[model samples]
Structure formats: C-alpha cells, structure tokens
Target: MRVFIRIFPLLATLTASFCVQAESLSARLADPLATEAMLPLRSASALAARVGERPCASELPASPLTPLDAVDLALCNHPQTREVWASARLQAAQVGVARSGWLPSLDGRAGVTRNFTDDSQLTQRNAALSLSWLLFDSGQRSANIDNARQLLDAALATRDATVQSLFLAALQTYYRAQATQAAVQAASDAERSARESLAAAELRYQVGIATPADRLQAQTAASQARLNTQRAEGDARNALGALANALGFPAQTPLQLAALPAVAAANEFQQDVDALIAAAQVRRPDLKAAEAQLRAADASIAVARAQGRPTLSLAAGPNWQRFEGETTRTGSIGLTLNVPIFTGFENTYRVRSAEAQLEARAAQRDRLRNQVALDVWQAYQSLTTATQTVQTSRDLLASAEQSERVALGRYKAGVGTVLDLLSAQSALASARVQRIQAELDWNIYRATLAQAMGALDYSLLQAAEGRP
Candidate 1:
C-alpha cells in the first residue's frame, strides 16, 4: 500500500500526459487540407472508421469542389497551416509594436499611501496626465525597427516553407497509396495463380501422373500466396491511413485517389544546372528565410551596440499635491539624457553575443545553400533515372504480358505443364509490381524535382497535365 501510494503521483502524471496528448489533435487542426480531404475519405473503409472524418464543404453549406479542386481548399482550411500563417500575421503585428516606440508614451498614476509613523493616516494622490517621448536614442530605435522588419520577413519565409513541406508530404503519401494498390493487385494475381497450380496438381495426382509430394508443395505454395495477399491488403490499408494523414484527413475516413494522372513524356531539352541553382538561390524559402535571419542578426548587432550609447527623452507631467491648508500644482517639462556608465560589462557581452549570433547565422546560410544545391542535384538525377526506369518497366511489362499469353495458349493446347503456366503468371505479377513501383518512383522523383525548384504550386497541375 505504501509503494502504491508513492507511485500514484507518477502514474497520475503519466496518465495525465497521455490524456492531454490524445486530446490535443492540434496538429491536424493546423493542416490546410483537413476539411476538404475528408469528403471522399468519409466513404472509404480505412479512413472512415477510426477517427471521425472531417466534414465536407458541401455538407456544411454552399460548396462546389471536385477531388482535384479540393487539394487547395483543404490546404487553405487546414488548422495547422492556418496557424502558421497566423503566426506570420502575429509577427507582422509585432512590427507595429517596434514602430510604436517612435511615438509618444503617456502614463496615468494614482496612489494611496499609509503612514507608518505617529498616528495612522492615509495619503491619497492622483496624477492624471503624463508624457514621455524619445527625442533621440543614437539610432537604437531605428535599428530595432529594422530588426523587427527583418524578423517579419523571416516569419513569412518560414510560413511558406511550412506550406511547401506539407504539400510535398501529401504528394508522397498519394504516390505511396498508389504503389500499395498496385501491390495488392499483384498479390491477388499470385494467389489466383497458386490456386490454379494447386488444382492442376490435384488433377494430376488423381490421374496417378503427379506424386503426393508435388501436390503438397503446390498446396503450401497456395497457402503462402493467400497469406501474401492478406499481407498486401493490410499494407494497402496502412498506406491509406498514411495518405489520409498527409492529405489532412481524419484517421477513420476512407481515402481514394481521384484518378491516375497521366504523366507527361520526358522533355528532350535538359534544363541547365546553373539555371536551376540560380532559381533555387532566389526562391527557396529556407534560403531566403535564412538570409532574412542573417540580416536580422546584423540588425541585432547594431541594436546591441547602440544600447551602450546615450538616449535623450523629452518628458512633461503635471503633479497636484494637497496638504493641510495648502494646495500645490506643479508642471514640469524637461529633456532627460541617460547614459549607461556601468552595468557589470552587460553591454560588452551583449555586443559580443550579437556578433556571435550573426556569425552563426551567416554560417547557417552558407550550409543551407550547400544543402539545397545537393538536394537539387540529387533530385535531378533521381528524376532522370525514374524517367528511364518508367519507359523500361513499361516495355518489360508489355513483354511479360505477351509471354503470359503465349504460355496460356501453350498450356491450353496440352503442350505445356501447369508449372510452366504458373511460372509465367509469377513473372507477369512481378512485372506488374515493378511497373507500378516504377510509376510511383517517377511521381516521387518528379515531386522532389518540383520541390527543389520551389515550384510546387498546385496551379502547376494544369501545366503538368498539358505536358506531353
């Protein structure tokens, strides 16, 4: 009982944490696609049962959207994406805060004080008017304002980067779902072919042409094939769940790809690497945001250095003091200058810190540039490989299909055994799987290329469709 009592608080804390985590679906709420992606998934088996699907636009009100049209709508409506955008807005509002320093500041004061000496008496006083304005700050206020502006630029870039990442995730999940679907079909084919082989073996055994061992082997193969099919089915469901998450749909909602998009033929002309790098250098959100951060850091250095200088302020206030049989009203206006003579080397350290921060940010910007270049190069190579693989896989699939047809014909003509037919079926299934995998790879690489180019705008869908 003592041990239980000792552990109770810890257990309670853990339980509380878990409950809070479960209740906080805040991440999905921030997604831009949460609402619109839920519509078609609501009827799908994988997504519609676990987590309550997001409500569709039409269900809520006057809404017109197709599956394709829903992508942007979902992005815009996603709670997470909206929150990021809202953060950008908040950062922009902070600029106002920095700018306000340039304006006059007013204060009102009212106080009541009790005397602790002699007879206990309360003193009440009120000052209703005040003024404080910065006449000069050695450019510190201006530098701070500049820093705020640069920070706002960084925030905007960060928001855009978040949007890009979300869309890329969605695209990857879609391609993965498509790949799993193909795998399921391939597994089904394998199962069917195994069953057919088992039947052939049984017929031969009954006619005394096949041994019991052969029949048993065929039966085992059929069982394994059935297991494979079941596994594929599970994988496909899991893929759907992942896709739903990427698309910002609820876990319980069902998801289906709208339709297989037609891929454009590869262009004969190759884009120059230098040109692509230049484009990325100009437009990549991470790079631009990093540069903004570096600029902000530079401004921060200025602010830190300025903090060591003198500040001049114009001040004016009216005071009213009342005493026994005496009343006094005082008005004062003065220019006050403040210079920090000493503060335990605080300013010196601050300036050093700011300079260090600036150096760190500059280094980070350089690192980001290098990483982006590498990513672009890798994506370009992968895209080229995917294009080649797609064409090759298609040709191989066609050849496998023809071979299977020929094998089936030979078997029906009594010139081929069931094993030969089964082999052909297996080959055909593999070819189909490969072809599907190739297509998925192509899509993934293409998406990566688009991302590297900072050209992942959904509006490009029109251009994508028009290509080839």
Candidate 2:
C-alpha cells in the first residue's frame, strides 16, 4: 500500500503524458497532409495538390489550355510526387524517434497467483512499475537526430527533382502538340496551293496553251498534297492524345491546346558554360539530395560508434504485493552505467560496415556531382543551338513563301511551267515544317535547360505564356 501510495503521483503524471502523446498521434494520423504542406509547392504552386494522399478532383476547363495550364495539371497529378512527399514525412517521424532517446520511459505490470500448499491455501497479488531515463549515450542520440534530419533533407530534394522532371515532360508534350497542329495548318495550305495550280494547269490545257503532261503532273501533285494533309491531321490528333496522356488524362480525352504565341518570347539563355554549371551545383535538387545522403551516412557512422560506448541511465522501480492477507511493499531508485562488454565482434563489424557505407555514399555523391555538371553543359549547348535554329528557320520560311508566291503568279500568267510551280510549293512546305520543328525544339530546350539547372518552377511556365 505504501509503495502504491508513494508511486501514485508518478503514475498519474506518466499516464497523463501517455494520454497526451496518444492524442497527438491520433490527430497526426487522422488525416493526410494537405497539398500545401509540400516543400516543393512553395515555389511551384501550380504543382500543388494532395496527389497521393487524396483523389485529384481536378476538372478540365472547357477552354483551351495554355502551356502553363498543361504543366500545372501534369505536376499536380503525378503519383511520384506524393511518393516522395510520404518518404519525407517518414524521415521526419524518424527524427522524432531519435530525439525520443533522450526522454524517460515508464511501464507498469500486474499479476495474480494462486498456490496449492499442504499448510495453507494462498493467493498473491503483485503490481510493479518501472521508470528509466537515459542520461548519456556518448552523443548517440544527437548523431541519430542528425542522421534523420539529413535523410529528410534528401527526401525533400528528391521530391523537388521529381517535380522538375515532370514539369519538363509536360512542357515537351505541350510543345510537340503545338508543332503538330502547326504542321497540319502548313499542310492544308500546301494542299490549297496544289489545288489552285491544278486548276490553272487545266485552264491552260483547255485553252491550248499547255500540254496534257503538264495537267497530269499538276493533278498528281494535288493528289500528293491532299495525302500529306490527311497525314498531318492524323499526326496532330496523335500528338494531342499524347499531350493529354502526359497531363494525366486518358488518350481518348479531348483536349484543345491554345494557339502558341505569334512570336515565342525570345529568352536570353546565353551564359558561360562554367557559370551555368556552378549554378547547377547550387540549385540542382538531386545533387543536394545526394549530398544530404552522404551527410546522413557520415552521421550513421557516429551512431554506430556511439552504440559501442558505455551509457549512463537513471532507473526506478516501485512495487506492492498482498500474500496470505499480509501486505508487502518495496521501492528502489539508482543510476546505472551500461558498458557493452562483448557482442561477438558485432560492434566492431558494425562500425566497419558503417564506414564502408559512408565510402559508398561518398562515391555516389561524387558521381552525381559530375553528372550534374555534364547535364547543365549539355542543356546549355542544346538550347544555344536551338536558339540559332529558330532564327535560321524563320528566315528560310520567309524566302520560301516569297519564292512560292512568285512561282504561282508566273504560272497563273502562263509563263511558268507546272513543274516550277510544284517545285516551289514543295520547297515552301519543307521550309514550313522546318520552322515549326525549330520553334518546338526551342521551347523544349528552354524548359530542359531550366530543369538541368534545378531552377524549373511555375515561373518558367508563366514566362513561357508571357504571364507576369
């Protein structure tokens, strides 16, 4: 009874602590985190959503989507985003686990027993409570906390990297769809021009000014142009379906993309390759994640070493027993120093294993670091080439348009051959295809460069649409 009375207050306090902790855990697990809790969404709100935590109820707008809108849908619906977000949360919980090593533990046990003896029948009731508080562990707790924090950091970086990759993907599909649409328009124009040439050839032959071969050639060119138009239209449909799929929609989902700007805003991405690589080292999330993993591995080594060291702890136990109708009570409190005497060379091997893991992580980080630099360099060169190609294609297109116009006029006036007309139209069609492709490449490369630098975000999408 005395021991029970003495320990009552301690039991009440510990029980209250346990209750609070249970409530906290219940509240934390009651619901999935809202999309706003994600670290990546701070800079890229367009990608914000409760991706895996909840169903995406996003409805497509009736109006055509611009490039930014396409990117937003793709990122928000990416299942991988939620996977990393969950991983980060898991690591955060582990950090809590590490910090908990500094806290005390309380436990209670109760039992009843009946004995059959020749002298007397007896019943016993026993209840005991134990308390233990870790006072020192050679900094193992701190090291564990550091490791968990680093892992969390790595998870966050990984999430960001995943989002950026998705962003680039959405951008690619959007640009490709636009390019296909433009090609369809160019093909239709060619078909119209071919039909007009065929009409002029027929009139000239009827008037005895052209040969039958000339009209036949014009007829053949018209048929070919009409075939090209049908192929272009089919390609445009396929491209739209691909874009829809990229944005997390079914291939059969109808999607209308907004017309690309008459002039895609020329971005000045020109910079020294060295400067870009340096920027990637700082801004690249994957590289940051790798560095964090290395740091976590380093901390793990500390944790492993600390596990082998002695630890100091405070412990207390209180108990009460009733036997043969007589009450007995006891209580004890003390400090204990626990030294790891031997573990069959377990600790020794553990430390070595930790060191080896640290080395592996270091090697991986270095490899990734080099890869980051290479990615930035390659993206920069590609974008530079795309920029030049866009301008050149535009010039070639202008000249082709003029040449085709002059050829059509001469044929209409009966001075140019149908062969010349068809040749000029073919050249014009090729130039148009080149120009559309150049424009698409430029847009994709722009997004790629931003992704390679780990600087891709909603702002890049906004800039593409000329949105402030």
Candidate 3:
C-alpha cells in the first residue's frame, strides 16, 4: 500500500498517456495535410471538409464549371489526391514513432491467485508498476528522429508535386472538352454549307446550266459533311466523359462546362530556357522531395553505426502483495549498461547497405535534376510553338472565311463553277478545325509549362487574368 501510494501519480500519468496515443477516426476528423505552397490543395481540402469548419458538397455545382472550379473538384474529389495526402499523414505518424524512442516505457500489472495447501486455502493479491528508460544510445535515437523528419519533409513535397500534376490534368481535360465542342459547331456549319451548295447545284442542273456530274458531286460532299458532323459529335461526347471522370464524376455523368477563356498573348513565359530551368530547380517539389530523400538516407548511415555502440538504461518499479493475512510493500530501482560484444558482422553489413542506399539516392536525385531541365525545355518550346500557331491559325481562318463567302456569292450569281465553291467551303471547314485545335493546344501547353516548373497555382490564372 505504501509503495503504490508513492508512485501512484506517475502511474496514473503513464497510464493516461499510453492508453491512447492516436486519435480515433470516428471520434474526430483527420488533420489537415495541405501546405501553403499547395494553394489548390488547401482550397480543395477546405471544400472537401478535410480541414474546414463545415462539410462541403461532393457533388458538382449546378453552374458550369470554370477551369478553377474543375481543378478544385479534381483536387478534392479524386482518389489519387486523397491517397497522397493520407500517405503524407502516415509519414507524419512515423515521425511520431521515431520520437517515441526518446521516451520511457511503463507497465502495470494486477493479479489475484488462490493457492490450496494440504489443510487450508490461501488467497494472494499482487499489484505492480514498472518503468524503464534509456539514458544513452550513442545518438541512435537522434539519427532515427532525423531520418523520420526528413522522410516527412519528402512526403509533404511529394504531396505538392502530385497536386500540381492533377491540376494540370484537370486544365488539359477542360480545354480538350471545349475544343471538341467547338469542332462540333464547325462541322455543323460545314454541313449547312454543303446542303446549300447541293441546292444550288440541283437548281443549276434543272436550268440546264450545271452538269449531272456536278449535282452528283454536290450530293457526295453533303453526305461526307453529315458523316463528319456525326463523328465530331461522338468525339465531343468522349471529351466530356473524360472531363467528368477527371472531376471525380461517373464517365456518363452529364456535365455543363463553361466556355474556354479567350486566348491572350503569353509573352510572360518567354524567358530564357536556362533561367527557367534554374528557377524550376528551386521551386519544383519533386526535386525538393528527392533532396529530402537523400538527406534521410544520410541519416540512416548514422543510425546503422549507432546501432553497434553501447547503451545505458535505468529501470524502476513498485510492488504490493497480500498473502496469508499479511501485507507487504516494496520498491526498487537500478541502472544498467549494455555493450554489444559481437553481432556476427551484422552491423558492418547494415552500415554498408545504408551507404549504398545513400549512393543510390544521390544518383536518382541527379537523374531527376537532369529530367527536370528537359521537361522545362520541352514544355517551353511546345508553348512557344503553340502560341505562334494560334496566331497563324486565326489569320488562316479569317482568310478562308472570306474566300468561302466570295465563292458562295459568285456561285449564286451564276458566275462561279461548282468545283470552286466546293473547294472554298472545304478550305474554310479545315481552317476552322485547325484554329480550334490551335487554341486548345495553346491553353493546354500554358498549364503544361506551369506544371513543368512546379508552380501550377492560381497565380498562373492571375497572370493571364482571364485564362487557365
């Protein structure tokens, strides 16, 4: 009874702490995983109620989703996004695990036993509380803690990289859907032009001015136009389905997407490639994650070496027992020093393995560093080409539209040949399709360049002021 009273407070505190070291999922909400660098993820996390005061709607809104809206939906609702964030949280727990190495351990036990003798029966009651703590471990605990912290850093950076990748994907899908819808409109207009040309040919043939072959050619062109319209409609639906899926909706979910923003000159991203690569090396989250991984690997080497060193520990406990109508209480404390005499070369092998892993991490970081440069180079060039193409395509479309109008007017006045009218109409249709494609490429490549630089954020949208 005396021993129990002496350490009861410490026992109570240890019991309270050891009883629940983790929060229950159903009892409370998970912690936030987004960092300041991940703007989209922070907004999405709030939208999904992951880190916000109130729950948000998983279902999309009734209004047409803009580019930013789509990105938010994807970041909040997509499984891949949640997976990486949860994984980062898991690594955070691992950090806690490593830190636990510095703390002492305690245990409590209670038992009642009935012992039968030849002539009588006796009852025994016993209770004990034990505590053990490590005083020194040759820096092993520090190294492990460092490794865990670096790993957590890597996990956070990885989460950012994944969020940026998903952001770019959402933007690309949105632009593609818009482009396909535009193609459908262009195809329908071409079909209308074809029908009008057929009507003219029919009238001219009946008036004995156009040949039967001309009428037949006109009919064939109209049929081809109709076929093209149907195909375009099909492609448009596919693009919508893909967009819906990206936003975490069913593939068949009907989505009303807002029109693409008007294209603006992206002269801001026209900086030197070398300078851009340098900036990316600093800002890229994946590269930062790689650096953290390398640091963690280095810490592992220290952990392995420390494992072979000596460790000192302290142990203490209190005991209470009752037997044969007598009560006894006792307490004891002791210090222990442990020396690793031999480990059959296990520590040597472990050290060598850690060193090799560090080397491997260094090589991988170098490889990724080179890859980042190439990605920026390619994305920059692609955006530059797409910008130029968009400009030229607009010019071509204007010229072709004028030619088609002139050809149709001349044919109606009975001065232009049926072949000339059909050729102009075809040229106009092709030019419209090309221009729509050019716009889509330009918009997608802009997001692509931002993603390559590891800076796909609302700032990119702000930079354009009206575009994704």
Candidate 4:
C-alpha cells in the first residue's frame, strides 16, 4: 500500500504526459491543416508548393509533327545547334574584321606626365590623333574574306548534315520501339498458349492418356514462355527509353508516337539507280561543302601570292595636337604608298600550303562522290528488300493464322495432341513478330533512302501518297 501510494504521483504525471502527447498526435492526424501548420517552415512550404502546383505542360511549344519533322524541330531548338550558329555568326564577324583592314583606322591619345629634376618639378601634357591605313598587303585580306565565306557555307552544310542524321536516328528509334511492342504482345500470346497447353496436358495425364513426361514438358514450356514474356517486356521498355531519349525527352517521360506515315509503294522504286545517284550528287550538302572548301583554298592561294606584292592606297586625315595651358595645333594628312620587301619566306610557304590543301580537297571531293553513290545504292537495296519482306510476312501471317485456327479446332475435337497445338501457336507468334520486323525495316529503309537522296526536307506523307 505504501509503495503503491509512493508511485501514484509519478504514475499520474506520466499519464498526464501521455494524455497530452496522444491528444496532440490525434489532432495532427485528424486535421491536415493543423498537421501542415506544425511542420517545419521550409518543409511545409515545399509540400504545399508541390501539392498546389500544376504540371508545367504549358512550357512546351505547340507544333505539328511527323517523326521526321519533330526531329528537325528538335535539332533547330537544341542548344548545340544554336551554339554552332553562333560560331558561324562569329566567323562572319571575323570576315568583317579582315575587310576593315582595307580602310584607314584612326586613334586618339591624351596623357599627362610629371618629372622631378634636381631642384624643380616639371609637368607636361599632350594629345595627338593619327590614322593608318593598309596601302597594300598583297591579297591577304581578299583571300581571308573569301575563306570566311566558304567557311560559312561549310557551317551551313554541316548543320544540314546533323539535322538529317538526327532525323534518321529518331525515325529508327521510333520504329524500333514499335517493333519491340509487337514482340511483347507476341510473347504474351505465347505465354497464354503455353499455360493452356499445360492445363490440357495435366488433364490428359490424370486420365492416363498422356505420359507424365508430357505433363512435365508442358510445365517447363510454360515457365519458359513466362521468361520470354519478361524478357520481351524488358526489351520493350528499353526501346521506349531509347526512343524518348533520341526525341530529346526526359528518360522518365512517357512517349506516345502517332501512327506511322504510309509507306512508299514498290512501284515508285522503278526509277533507275544511276538517276538517283546523279540526283544525290547534285543536292547533297556535304558535297557542296567540300566544293566550297576547295574554292576557298583556291582563293587562299591567290591571297598568299599577293602577299608578296606591294600595295598602294590613297589616304587623307586631319590630326590634332593639344598642349596643356596652350592653344591646340592641327596638321593635314597625305597619301601613302607601301611596298612589301620580304616576309622571311612566310608568304611563299603559305602559298604552297594553300595549293596543297586545294589538291587534297579535290581528292576528298572525289571520294565523297564515290561514297555517296555507294550509300544510295545500299539504301535502294535495303528499301527493296524491306518492301518484299513486308509482303512476304503479310502472306505468312495470314497462313499462320489459318493454321493456328485449324489446330485449335482439332484440339477441341480431341483429335490433336498438345504438341500439335503448341507448334501451331509458336508458328503464329513467330509470324506476328516477323511481320512487325518487316514493317519496321521498311520504315527505316525508306527514311534512309530519303536521306541519301537529300530529300529529308521533303514531306514523307506526300511522298507516300497514292501508293499501295
């Protein structure tokens, strides 16, 4: 009794604390407003900010897009593309800087200096303005200007090439994702068939009409089918990730590709391969860039040779001289003629180097032409093969569908073994997968051919219109 009494007050205090704490927790659980209010200031604000915020979807620009057009737009908007353009603009400025040498430049100077003599201090102030212009520097300035123009051309061509390649890569990724999705579906169907077969095998074994070994085989097959489905699902997810990344989306962002544009008909490939080659040579940007580089090199040679020659120019400018605490004085400018005695063989070497560069560029241009021809030919073959595969796969799918139907009918009539049913199921799944591959291949090849022909800027939809 004594001990009980002694512990009573302590227990009462503990109970009171517990009651208060419970009440506080219950209030928090019951009232979200109270709970939020009790949270740390920054944390609560963060939570509210997250909860009250709407998605930033409005930040995205609106545009009409086929896959290729979307890629073109992305390239245009990309930071790297903007930076490259900036570089080109800088090169343009450099050209202006080089051309400015042809005109006279004027400069002004003003300063005051103090000198201490043995016993006296002297202060002197003076201001003068003068101008200098290049009477002649051979043809260096002209050559530099020409080179800048060619560089601009090359930059533009490079930009175009990047755009084309990115467009093709996006198309390829999109089609690959579609193919993987198809494969996943095929895998799921296979899994379902295997499960059904396993059930049938079990029933037959129980009735002593099927061997235990058959039942085990069916079970193993079902397990393998499930594994295949898992693998296919993983592959499909990876493909989606790749496509989204290529399209310049966040890795976690969901992708929704619109229906593929109609494929070009087989009949349109009737144009001669040689004609296609000729078209590409004329239109391809890289070839144009190479040609421009060659011309620029030729201009450089001229500029170099001119560097060794004398230059004459007419120049006139007024100069002003000011003295502290005195009147300002002025003088008149006159014409100047300058002659280049020597540059220590610098100009000679430069000319020779420019000549060699020109020769190298000519060789490269020839190589580019050959490579373009080969690319066109390869693209043509791929397109032809893909179209034929699409046709063949379509027919195979139709036949496989019929075969599966017949096998299922026989099974229902108790006249088919599980083996027959399984075989037919496998065949149908393979056909579907093959058909998807064929379609994807066709799309890729078509895009490649368009790229090779320098027709990426053309409308894919228009190109495929009125074709089978």
- TM-score, one value per model: 0.78, 0.88, 0.88, 0.79
Runs with alpha carbons beyond 4 Å of true place in candidate 1: 1-83, 112-128, 194-221, 324-327, 341-344, 464-468
Q: What would the per-residue lDDT of candidate 2 be over residues 171-256, giving only the tens digit for each residue? A: 88888989888999999999999999999999999999999999999999999999999999999999999988887789889988
Off by over 4 Å in 3: 1-43, 46-57, 462-468
RMSD in Å for all candidates: 13.9, 8.1, 7.9, 18.9
Off by over 4 Å in 4: 1-73, 76-79, 135-138, 261-265, 313-324, 461-468
What is the C-alpha local distance difference test score of candidate 4? 0.72
lDDT of 1 by residue, 1-468 (tens): 999999999999999998888666665555322322312221112111222334333221133222333444345445767676666666666676777788898998766554565766656554556899998998898898899788878877777777777667666776787788879988998788778777877877888776797678778878988998999899999987765554556665576555566655485425998788778888898888999999999999999999999999999999876654366788889999999999899999999999999999999999999988988888888888888888888899899878877876665555666667767877887888888888888878877877887776654554554431
Over 355-446, each residue of candidate 3 has an lDDT whose tens digit, in order, gives 99999999999999999999999999999999999999999999999999999899888999889999999999999999998898898888
For candidate 4, lDDT tens digit of each residue in 1-468? Answer: 999999999999999999999998998665523222322222112211222332112122343334543454345444555565555556555566666666777888777788888998766776676777776666778888787678767766665666566667766877787778878888998898778778878887888887887788789888988999999999989987876565567666666555565454475764899999999998887888888878888887887788777776655445444345565666666666677677888978988998999999999999999999999999999998898998899899999989988886776557887778778878988898898888889878888998898776435633553221
Decreasing lDDT order of the candidates? 3, 2, 1, 4
- Candidate 4 colliding pairs: 138-306
Candidate 2: Cα lDDT at 223: 98
Q: Which of the numbered candidates is closest to the native, going by highest lDDT?
A: 3
- lDDT against true structure, model 1: 0.73
Once fitted onto the true fold, the runs of candidate 2 whose alpha carbons sit more than 4 angstroms away are 1-57, 117-121, 264-267
Per-prediction tally of clashes: 22, 0, 0, 1
